[model samples]
Target: MTMPAFVKPRQVIGHHLVLRDATPADAEFIVALRTDESKSRFISKTSSDVSQQVAWLEKYAQDNSQVYFIMEDREHNPVGTVRLYDQQGDSFCWGSWVIREGSPSGYAVESALMVYQFALSLGFTRAHFDVRKGNESVWKFHERFGAVRTEETELDYFYSLSREAIDKSLAKYAKFLPGGIQVIAA
Candidate 1:
């Protein structure tokens, strides 16, 4: 059977938030979050310059191997970002999840659910990602979502979640996105 191509949906609308494809215009916002002292501690470091981020985004536009998104609330206010990449057969990796401080509650759960739903729709059966060793809250969240600890390194904890686990998590958190998400075509 022919494998499915990665999807780059224009939008994935949920109950409280919507994820839209990232653009160069979001460079400053992305840079701001990536450079925030409190938020940057767990994720990889990036250049603080918005122009650099713009260049990176321009390059990213040509790469179909990944999908990057900027999350927004109903009013179209930017709140966070997430990405899916590093595909290997039926498995894919997702990361760069960061939500703005002071945002309303339940966003985290909704974002995770939306990500899994979007990935599943693209035909990915499993996911593998690493959480920083110091990011206890994130790792714990994944554990509670049924992701298994597969290994670890000096700075990060690797985890794996099968399709079954993903489905379970989606069901468990169904309340957060009771109406499910609406994916708009690219």
Candidate 2:
């Protein structure tokens, strides 16, 4: 079956950033972004090889369960990467999210709000992800969106945010979403 547009939107526009689908051509950037020294400690280990990244994207292209995006600034400069994955019954998982270390203050908020809006628009009732236990900074970051801790593994803390909860938190960040988040039709 064909996945919905929110699962693989060609482009998602926010006030300060635009998230575009990651193409095979973006393999190099993805590799560099994920392997960058500054951001490496926050995420799980990823391939440093371009060819390996390309192979992964090729495989991902066929897997409707995962969607990758390259987040860029209003001027179209790469900011970071994010993904919505593991589409199952009524919930999906979201992560692979990162914003460039020194990107302007707004990029981080825009990227996250866009993803939560995208998931809700696509009919997902809930979203889940795990942040490293040591990453207290980001744990607090996700809290801004009403994410509640659901699990605590030795290495990570899992969070679950319901669409209802996310919606309630939208107003707090509404000023950051330019067009006020275009919710796709069901």
- How does candidate 2 score on lDDT? 0.81
Return the TM-score for each candidate structure: 0.97, 0.90
Q: Model 2: residues >4 Å from true position, as ranges?
A: 1-6, 182-186
What does candidate 2's lDDT look like per residue over 55-129, in tens digits? 988888887777788998879888899999876666778889878778888777878888888877777778788
The residue-level lDDT of candidate 2 at 32 comes to 86
Q: By TM-score, how accurate is candidate 1?
A: 0.97
Top TM-score model: 1
lDDT of 1 by residue, 28-96 (tens): 999998898888989989899899999999998889999999999999999999999999888889999
Go through the candidates in order and give each one's C-alpha lDDT: 0.92, 0.81
